[model samples]
Target: MWKITYSIVGYDPVEKEWGVATQSKFLAVGAVVPFAVAGVGAVATQSYANTSYGPEGMEHMSSGKSAQETIDLLTSIDEDRALRQVGMIDGQGNAATYTGEKCYDWAGGITGKHYAVQGNILIAGTVEAMAKTFEETEGTLADRLLASLAAGQQAGGDSRGQQSAALLVVKKAGGYGGFSDRFIDLRVDDHKTPVDELIRIHRIHQLYFSKSKKDRIVPIEEQIAETLDHQLTRLGYKKEDQPLLHTFKDYLHTENFEMRAQEDGFIDLDVLEHMTRS
Candidate 1:
């Protein structure tokens, strides 16, 4: 029996996104909890987790079931329903949760308009703190979700302690190079402070992977070339007859900044900042 103490699964109507953030004393709680699919919904199955709840629950939601309907149908069929705990939020912003009668002390979940928060073997305030944070935080869905997780931790997370943490968020074709919906999938499999570790890992991922704002784009100018040349030279680049502009362009591609750069000679200011900052 797994003991995943806390999780939040929610939908963002503005971005048409779904995400789950979870932390636990159990090793690799990320693997046992979050399950989601783009244009479908998000689910976190915990307590004595029934892994099947993920795929099957998503199947029902994708086929037009409301969040409550999906939860009802799925749990009703589980002979061990009383041993399971689940939280779900569907594509249309409907939310529902079920905490089985037989779940451990402090095991329960609460649903808001477009989100659900749940926990087992947690401090009494953990799940409630998560819900409050999600509602009050600003920025993108990912940012809000992370804030909720942090708040949950601040309010005293899993009573047993911490070991692993994970974050998963999905959007249509939002993955690397637009090939998949997995916009973010990060895990701290083992750590003395998994939440803090996961947050640091996420920042690095965002620097390299997240989309750059259009306003940050700047045309290649002589000053820009000089900046690149100065920074690159410090990093052992030699001034060649080859233009530093082309050299910087090559560097951008090498560093996977293709999404924010155009060989036509315009680049995102963040790229330049990245070059100088790094």
Candidate 2:
């Protein structure tokens, strides 16, 4: 009487490789639902929390197993034949997913060239809808994964109602400083709209946390000094009493510019916008 929905997209531009995987459960499941290895372009998504497949599947992919081969190996190894569902994608774009007969109602998946989407115990006919929406959506692999999550939400995600949602994407040199995973790694443990909130957080990540495209240092030029003076004056620091402004500037330069004039109990920038009219 529960459903879990998830998706992953892994792209490595240098290798020209891409892979996608997804699975779901009733709670804020972690690597249990989906896992990806950056260098290999492989993903393992197991439902009913068949975690053994995660590492084992990666092993197969590392040894050059195609997605289908890895899935077959996992399904074949599970002694309790009717108690597992798994999906995998490999570097070569091959894909596969499995739904054991013993799984709860309305559990299945669809595999595509570069992606495989799956869910279990979802409301009505959500699994097919989720898969169809994922395949139809266009954009970066990350966008397609997000679209899959959106589709799951639209099709009545998690029959028990929303609690948490997560997204994980991987690629080589993706992480900050070229160190770790580069794409979305967001989680909403409990919310009225977990997926929506996840998307908002993802946007925030894109803005400030991803990578600095522009140099952040403000040049100490005359025009910039004038702007700083204007900002200080609007805060009620008169030009004659601007001796305090010199001290503030000294503090700014001395402290690595960590001190902003606005934070010194002066005019708030938000208020400054209104002060222009006043």
Q: Which 10 successive residues of model 1 have the least lDDT summed?
A: 235-244
Over 1-278, each residue of candidate 1 has an lDDT whose tens digit, in order, gives: 86757889888899999999999888898888999899999999988889999999999999999889999999999999998999998889898989999888778888887899988878888889999999998887888888888998999898888999999999999998889999899999899999899888897788777677878877777888677778877766545786776777667777777666664777777767777767
lDDT string for model 2 (92-173, tens) is 6667777788877666777765667666667766766767776788765666676777777788766766666667776667
Question: How big is the positional error of residue 5 in model 1, measured in Å on the Cα after superposition?
Answer: 2.4
Model 1 lDDT, full chain set: 0.86
Q: Compare the candidates by TM-score and give the number of the best one.
A: 1
Superposed model 2: Cα runs more than 4 Å off: 1-25, 211-278
User: What TM-score would every model get versus the actual structure?
Assistant: 0.88, 0.70
**Pairs with steric clashes in candidate 1:** none
Clashes of 1: 0
